[model samples]
Target: MDCDVLVVGAGAVGAVAALGLRRQGYRVRVLDAGQPMEAPTGEAIDPRVFALSPASIELLESLDLWPRLAPRAQGYAGMTVWDAVSGSDIRFRAAEFGLDGLGAIVENAALVSAAQAALDDVEFGAALAAVDETTDAVTVTTDDGRPVRARTLLLADGANSPGRQALGIAVSGRGYGGRAIVCHLRSERGHDVTAWQRFLPSGPVALLPLFDGRVSLVWSADDALADRLLALDDAAFSDAVTEATAGRLGALHTPTRRFAFPLRRQTAERFTTRRCVLLGDAAHVVHPLAGQGVNLGFDDLRALLVAMPDPDVGLRAAALRRYERARRADIAQMSQGIDGLDRLFSTANPAVSTVRGFGLHLADVVTPLKRRFAEVALGVKPGFPSASG
Candidate 1:
């Protein structure tokens, strides 16, 4: 085999995967169709950011990548979620859980840069064209007709993964018929280092605190509303956001460019074949209502690493099966929970809204229940009983 493992995609997850495997003394080859993202410069922040759980932070620290990301990461100590229609709210504090913060918000480009910097050999502009798997090794043919072979294949190519398609893996789920608009805005008041989210009938709008006074906004809305919001001028759009969030952070202004992507809930029929395993968005896509998308991907990587501590046995079918079994339940539970919340909040029914509001209220006051939710968010607890099977 050309290498111990061939990673097809150098996004945050893929690059980090390569870094982790290389640290374990494995010969790993990484391929990506695009060049590495340039590190963010100046005062501007990349609109694409992730809320990294403690578990994810631990993984990055273990791989010696956290030092690079820590400078730019912004930690949030509390989170407040509320219902716009029913005026119900729930708050979570890291202090309540005996932690400094729930999670840190890190820009995507920064993470990619850090991971890429830690790894010496990531072949950019190389795309996977074909895959030939056998009993012992998996070989990939690049679009340029270059052949790359490995003991096993790791597909982190993303939700629309060509690697997954090449393996004839099928993903099943429907789009939410909505899009999430993300950008940075300067709020009049400080965010108090709190992550704020309000569920409108259309969707959920989140304002995550940044190191700077500005907040990162992720507003998930239905198609029509999304189009309308995107069509508005900067002032009007910012005003709409202020209204949607009920002026929680005061009048928002100085908005950055807005970008939106369609929402979907997808899961691969299977996470592993005989010699190849899928990771990150390649295996599952969840709604962004909970800001757990990238974190789930990190969780996937951590589980795979734990299952495959030694490359000698890690490439075997049994180890791959162990990784798959450990992750599927957590991913499914998170996907279903986020999808359910999206559906629940998207409804305009008076009765259902009232009930959900009451549920949120109850969850807020119930210490044990709230603690459990916090544990899941922190990634300290898995959605299933055995996250490490």
Candidate 2:
């Protein structure tokens, strides 16, 4: 009936946030409405794996989620970005950045399951009926007709957050004519735990190698192509993906059932309203080209934990404003950069293609610039979660 902190949503961000707050000496309660998805996102395998940056790993590690996740995780010591249409690509080595690995490829459901297991206690299947903010505390009523009272409420409900709306927080976002086709595929050669991304005329295709001989695919393509791929049978679909990706993985075979989600950019104008604060997808959503959506959520987790006030309401409006302002530029830069990259590479013009190819080659040749990217991708150059320098 009551808790020191109440988190709505048991997805990636919400689970992590609840665990973080609980570890901070607060009595935390989590409410999740969706049936906890088990065994990944497909019949054959889970295609919804995440490329966890070092920052995310560190955050989870601190919460003791990484150790439980290590057995299932696939680590990449480097990453390669190539232009499929043009023979241009850039290689990023973790060694160049003085890190052990570029990042880790983690199955999505596995991650939350691990995080929840590490947590002391978390309640599921309770839909939040209402969230009412008061001067001193916030009261949340659940579908089961139970009122969960908390000194502070964190809403991590997700991109199209009902919690944000119920709490009267203003959110802003717009859709891009892009959809991502995701699935798992087997390769002849081992990926060596390396992450690969190729930018095509339509959009970007990312191949994150898993522990086994398979790789999870995230292909951001145009609307029409997405529909076609979603409709294709398993056999035909594999061939289409391979052709679109140009057989980069030495022939992608055995594609599991595919799923697609619309792409969009969303950012809440106000991070905090009254006693409730927005975190994760509740705050913003960015293009997945750079794989920054969950990474942004990790950033939110770190910021809130590090800056939480003594009392839940101790978070001053000015401080919350500062946090929102600080995050705006980074989120905006990533959204604009990814959106621009999609626009630049999605064109069919000969001139634009030629220039983009040349730019890729330029990045490949520049050692310093390439290393900088490696550091950023490792998620530890600076301003990352907890790891410094």
Candidate 3:
């Protein structure tokens, strides 16, 4: 065999997976169809960012990637979520849960650069052309007619993973008919190291604090509204954001380019097949309302490592089964919960709005329930079985 494991894709998850597996004494090779990610330039921040949970931070620390990202990452000590229609809001603080902060906001490019720097080598420009799985091993052919064999293959490509399609793995989900707009804004008032989100009829709008005193905005709006918002000039767009957020951060001004991407929730039919398996976005894609998509992918990596402690027995059917079972429930629950929130908030029905308002208010006042929500967000109490189970 060319290696013990072949990781397809060199994104944050795939690079980290390869590093983890290699540290476990497994020979690992990584393949990516695109060139290596370039480091962020100048003082401008990438619009693509992720709110990484504590569990995810630990994973990165374990891989020694956190040190590189620590300088750039911003920790939000509190979060406030509200309903635009009902005027109901719920607030959470890390101190309430005996923690210093809730999570860290890191730019996507920074994460990719850090992971890639740690990765020994990656075969960029090599796409998976075909996969031939057997009882003992799996062999993958690249687009350039190169063949690579390994005891197992992991697909960490994005949601529309070509590697997954090549394996005939089907995904199930629906488009949200909306697009998420992301950009950094300069706020007149300080963010106070807080993350604020308000649910509107269009969708949810979030203002996440950045390390450099700027706020990263993620506004999910319906297709038509999103198009109109994107068409606005910088000043007009900033005004729209201020209005959407109810002027929570005072007058906001855009200092960077805006980006928008379609929203969708998808899950693969299965997480594994014979000697092949799916990880990260390849296995699941959840709505970004809760900013848990990337965190969930990190969870998948953690579970896979736990399920297969021994390289010799890790890729076996039993081990793979354990990993799949452990992750499916968590992913399904999160996806469904976020989708329900999206639906609940996107409606103009008076009765529905009233009930959701009351629900949010109740969750805010109920200490125990609010604590539970914080724990789940921190990944301290994963609502799924462990690998040993």
Candidate 4:
């Protein structure tokens, strides 16, 4: 089993990476230990949804996968965020940026399914048993006793990537003593095409709109609170969520089954070694408060593809190092920024609260600075590939 590139995960990021490489005429083979995601159906919103940035949307469009997902996506025209304790609120409108919306929210499974459909083949339930790298190529052994050879092996298997560990790549991260609670809820007031977030002392709570008049909930809570909330019955949990959100959308109810995952900050010490390289969560995992986890993964694909557009060029260590260096700085900046903001909000000191409030208000009133922030968040600024191209 030899190919141009071997993608070690079939999730949205890995699938999209494989699709992009294929578009560049690479004979790509994707291997995943998990089963393929089924196409979503029915009226209910998938509990796992991603707020796709403009750059992510463009990446999908460039790969010709956005059209398959567009009808199922919900576009938010504005974003409203406030501090639960300080009463400081900031709103960003799409009209202000002359864009239709801030971003599109699509189910995670749907995006992967769409990307899978575009691929020629993906080896499902194929756990990687071992990896052997050489100067010119890499050989991967699967659980089924099959061997795969490729010029480059993309280890996008996620945060706790086995490939990275097998190759002895170190990672530095710490548990944030918090867990994210995710679910879908029906709000009393319409979401109004606005993505709302309220930063509580424990963590931030986001109510992202869905296409079917519902909103997805992402509550980052302290570990104990998360356990307590999850232990409650559905009705009680919904009430807790409504209270936590201050009923901004009137009242939230009809919550789907809740899901929770521990929050942490992780960064791979090295992004590449030999003929293998890390991508997406495999390289870094940041706070979910900003909803940029998957977006960062897409950016990884964009950077890697741009650096080495063709597989035939071979996966050179120098090229991989360039991609690693380029992404490390941006990842560090985002990781630090989000961590700093989380710490700032977590503090209960009145003086810190006042300073934070003032900063949010100042950014809101300053048009140039606000637009610059928006551009950075949307990934439409310079240094990224455009859909038009």
lDDT accuracy of residue 277 in candidate 1: 94
Q: What is the lDDT of residue 228 in candidate 1?
A: 98
Clashes of each: 0, 0, 0, 0
Candidate 3: tens digits of C-alpha lDDT, residues 1-389: 99989999998788888888877778889999999887776677888999987778878888888999989999887899899999998898776666666789999899988787788589899999999999889999999999999989999988998889999999999999899999999999999999899999889999999989999999999899999998999999999999999999899996589899989999999999878889999999887888887888888998989887878778677887888899899888878777777888888789999998998889898977675555444343433222221
Instruction: Give the lDDT of residue 214 in candidate 2.
Output: 86
TM-score of each: 0.96, 0.91, 0.95, 0.95
Query: What is the full ranking by lDDT, best candidate first?
Result: 1, 3, 4, 2
In candidate 2, the residue pairs with backbone N, CA or C atoms under 3 Å apart (3 or more residues apart, or in different chains) clash, namely none
lDDT of 4: 0.84
Q: Assess candidate 2 and give its lDDT.
A: 0.76
Positional deviation of residue 249's Cα in model 3 after best superposition, in angstroms = 0.6
lDDT at position 364, candidate 3: 92
Error of 4 at 62 (Å): 0.9
The reply for model 4, stretches above 4 Å from the true place, is 312-314, 368-389
Which lDDT value does model 2 have at 196?
A: 85
Provide the lowest-lDDT 10-residue window in model 3: 380-389
lDDT of 1 by residue, 1-389 (tens): 79998999999999999988887778899999999778887677999999887677778888889998888899887889889889999898776766666788999999999898788678999999999999888999999999999988999999999999999999999998999999999999899989999999989999998877789999999899999999999999999999999999999998999999989989999999888999999999888878887888988898888878877778777888999999989888877767777777877799999998898899898977776556544454423223241
Candidate 3 or 1, higher lDDT: 1
